[model samples]
Target: MNDIVDLFVIGGGVNGTGIARDAAGRGLGVTLAELGDLAQATSSASSKLIHGGLRYLEFYEFRLVRESLQEREKLLAAMPHIAWPMRFVLPHHSGLRPDWMLRSGLFLYDRLGGRGLPGTKRINLRSHPAGALLKPSFRTGFEYSDAWVDDARLVVLNARDAEMRGATILTRAKVVSTTRHAAHWDVEVERDGRIHTHRARKLVNAAGPWAGKLSETTGDPHRLRLVRGSHIVLPRLPGHDQPYILQGGDGRIVFVIPYEDDFTLVGTTEAEHHGSASEAVCSPEEKAYLVDFVNDYFAHPISTDDIVWTYSGVRPLIESEGSARSASRDYQLAYDDDGAPLLTVLGGKLTTFRKLAESALERLGYGGQWTARAPLPGGTFDRRQGVAMIGRWMEAHPFLTEAWARRLLRSYGTEAETILGNAATAEDLGQDFGATLSEAEVRFLMRHEYARTAEDVVWRRTKLGLRLDAGQVAALDAFMAEARGEAAAAE
Candidate 1:
């Protein structure tokens, strides 16, 4: 901890981890410290789309949209397991923007970034399968290609890849203080009731919502506007697999997408958040807003009673002269080299994390942008081989149900084989905590993925929390606790 490293990153969200991975791959000695678990905040609370920010076109953020669209293709190719192409159906509403406007936007979107996926096309609501559950007034819709991602897992995988390339990832570690020296930084980190000081040539303040507060310690005079975005999950709407992009009357848009296998994920509302970012939650008002937003289009209206789960995250946007909904989604990297170098990341979305990382390093006087081609851990195979990989898993282990096999392939990719090992039967994989969550898989996550608690395993590492009942979750908690105790005793 006393040795000076090349970089010290203060955050474990998408941007922080992406920077660590990219820097480590370029032969920089990097260390990343997270106040809590990885993706414990805004990074995990995204709408889970890797699109080019189609709505931003109206805001005239062409540069951000173009970079994001380009990054979307690279990210999907890099992590085929956790990210994939998803088509979004935007229903035409006569009361809102005109059809020609929508067409023009989609046309620009299709050509803005390099074409890795299918382009936009018009569809008849009465004939398209995605429109079956919609209200009768919608006669036309536009379908465009974007990508879906396991947001939380994406953060964890970046941390994993960073560690694989020689970056030190510290979780449950909080930076209590930082002192700038002539040539290096002295960062005091508190973990496990002990304080450790690490010296680094440069520091990166990538803390999402907390970045503004952290910047105050260094006298960085940048202000951030905290915007809270919330989402709600419900039982899957019984019709199609494609997601919907609903245009709200407030000039904002919401997404209702298929989540996990049995639920629908609808989001999100932009409200000015006051107070602590960690305290942000899906308020009753926000929940009502979302339920009403979707009810406007769905033929079978849904009430708040249908909601199964809710989550919210606070976004730290650079102070702008507009409403929260109109604030920019693009990022700004401010590098201050007064004493020791400090790069503060402000206002970024999930789709552009990789690009943000490359830019961050270049600002720090480092080069070699190699993350675009490097695959994340277990994502070494081509994206087209995903189905073949699943088939191989099922063929190798007949005990695995088709659903279970597909889940494993999607979650871990090539690493799924390592978890299976030589187990010929489901019983060999150890205790089944229901919903196909096996003890072997749980241990693998704890051993390799830095999973410390059942919440980390179920909620962040995987969305199996939606399937596991309270009792099953309790059992998982007890098991993980006992396992940790045994590990400590062994040490």
Candidate 2:
């Protein structure tokens, strides 16, 4: 049995953690439960972007676009470590959207959010660096500004901040059942082969694709349409630092972004997903579709064989009459106060998560909105200081490599020193499990970041999974398990 909390969050994704962080910061007791590792599902498998959906303008989603654009700068400022600005080049295809339409859309996008980022401009592809990599047919293009993010890290940071603000975070804790009463709700959470009971004054369903199924238990009539968005990673396409937004004839768009320095990330295909959301994988068709889509734009065509990695996430969108690509990225907060207040988050995107959290709290009648101005964990410094911070790290620790220092800065920002701590040489960081993943860093992640498994460390906490091989991953997993066992035995 546990003390009755003010809010019980069911899920550990972006939305759930965001709500927990917001509520906890406002002096509300919060407990968040996740069935798996934090960001093990949809949250970690995103296209890794924090941008207003440029294509949403085509569907006349003015409100969604406006909200997302407004949030873009705020989010970037909040977490400069994990989120930073990126320039996107959209090649003007004669057969697709016309020049005037693109210009008009870009114009609206630039002004919609008060123009914090650089505005759009027309560029001659033949003379531009990005154009050198593109097909000759793309003589001209439009460049606009957006941002990139480490999607999984964003969720973990929110959870970390929430925990710091007095919220209880339970990873691998499954909410087995929930019983609502007139004043509170009784929730049963199963973890470590045992079931724990908790009581809360309010319940939140931020389970992403699983929200629909969880709604049945709360007796809420809301449903969600599961749409799978998949992405493929290929070896880095040279000659361009800016990412390209390739327009497709099928009214879809694919992003070819530089990823992890040595690789390129191209995605994502929108397809209606069925069955279990957890089982969603990048299918052969999705891979082929992405390959074919990029081939149309790149001067050097790539086959599916060039794909080094693929990931898929099932997005729980609002049930509407349209194709999955045309579905709304806008979120709806369904507040059911028949008994205990139940707030169900329906649909949302990465860019507007903070706004969504504000809305969720507002629905629950909690006021003091503070996340917009506050920085997340490890993000207390100015956004523009990232590069200087990394340089300082290298200057202070002359033994550290530029790549290692840069990775640490990007992952931990000002807190990287906490891990580096008094180490005069790289050997002081202890065992290296390949890909610059030192034991010191691993311990920090496990102790502070709620990282239990290597999957959580490599894939979610940092993208070292792209660099580590199978044997190295296995070794890392073994090391983590052994470390956990030793800690448990000691306890």
Candidate 3:
């Protein structure tokens, strides 16, 4: 729209925003544009683990598992508010893999990439609290440590950090076209029905499932394996906070995680996606597959009727010769600088987005690995400080419920203070949208987090959608629409 920037990133997913944040922090001008809300796709649909892909070891993805393991510790340390350690229980299935194999794999997992988490140990399920929930036949199991993260929040924070570092962040903006030039590239982006043209010395295509399509804009044809992964959320199991990793007859593994505060998150089936990513959904067959698998292990049985919600996302995996289940989650960068500089990110995972960004920038001829240690926006405190911050907020604002305070702290971290402001009581929050969603928090998300819709706030920014009633959601939607209209009129 104005001066030529150093880098123009297409796609506001984890990789695009991460590269923009990295490039901007290194004194390079950066601009990022997304067609929709950040992390509205695969980034938010993950199984929500920051593990080393323990199952990846069987496929001999040692390198990926190692890198992921290393990132787990870094991310856990960097953002303790939205991320924390979770213990996973893997029950032994002699019918699938042998006990010796499981033990050996666990050993390698514990030693790989400087394990900061607890080592694996065998347990008697019958005696363990988690075991009581399982069938009596499942007598033995193993427990190990991994972390859970708010995947959508991770993308948003990166974008926020990038904007603070002088990158132009545009949501609901689509890259209409791009043309190569001698020293730069001209890009046209459509936002609010207006076409804005800009110039950049370098262009990056990190469009997730749309990367291949974006590459076509540059006259390069690239294909990726679009694997649809789907997850189902059930009403929370009565006891235990720990999650389970169950093996299937087909050799694939499914995770049954503790989701939100009152739900069990189970998934996912990896089937080849035939259509656009936007149309991906949990097929009826996949639903039956998951239900049957879980029923095979747990004492309490559930059918599709028990599922409260389901989500699906298409992963743009590097095309490889194998079943979609065995496809590589590793990413590749295709750099073409024949006349104008262009770098297209082929495939990537949520855990390795930072390293992928650094590599992308280095290929674009940028300097330094500054993002490795830098904290994300609102992530300046250590784990102890995070707990203390929550305690202090609860102390100062005695009107706030413990559950509300904890949720806000985990979602916004220290920025919750800004949203709380000088409000002495709950009424100052303006309007109560139910499920602890106050108007103050909604405005905070709108003002800073690029949340333009109630779905953006309820589903992605916060999982409060699961708790809100239908009428509450409709009211929130109406409120957001009015607020957006008012803001547009003012502008």
Pairs clashing within candidate 2: none
Sorted on lDDT, best first, the list reads: 1, 2, 3
Off by over 4 Å in 3: none
Model 2 stretches astray by more than 4 angstroms: none
Q: lDDT: which is higher, 2 or 3?
A: 2
How good is model 3 by TM-score?
0.98
Clashing residue pairs, backbone N/CA/C < 3 A, model 1: none
For each candidate in turn, the TM-score is 0.99, 0.99, 0.98
RMSD to the true structure for each prediction, in A, is: 1.0, 0.9, 1.1
Q: What's the distance in Å from true for residue 450, model 1?
A: 0.9
Alpha-carbon error at 326 in model 1, in Å?
0.9
Model 1's lDDT to the true fold?
Answer: 0.93
lDDT of 1 by residue, 1-491 (tens): 67899999999999999999999999999999999999999999999999899989999999999999999989988998899899899999999999999999999999997778999999999989988989999999899999999999999999999999999999999999999998999999999899999999999999999998999996675789999999999999898588999998899999999999889999999999997999999999999999999989999999999999999999989899988888999999999999899999999999999999999999999988899957888889988888888788888898888889889878999999989999899999999998999999999999889899999999999999999999999999999999999998999
lDDT for position 232 in model 3 = 93
CA-RMSD of model 2: 0.9
Error of 1 at 129 (Å): 1.3
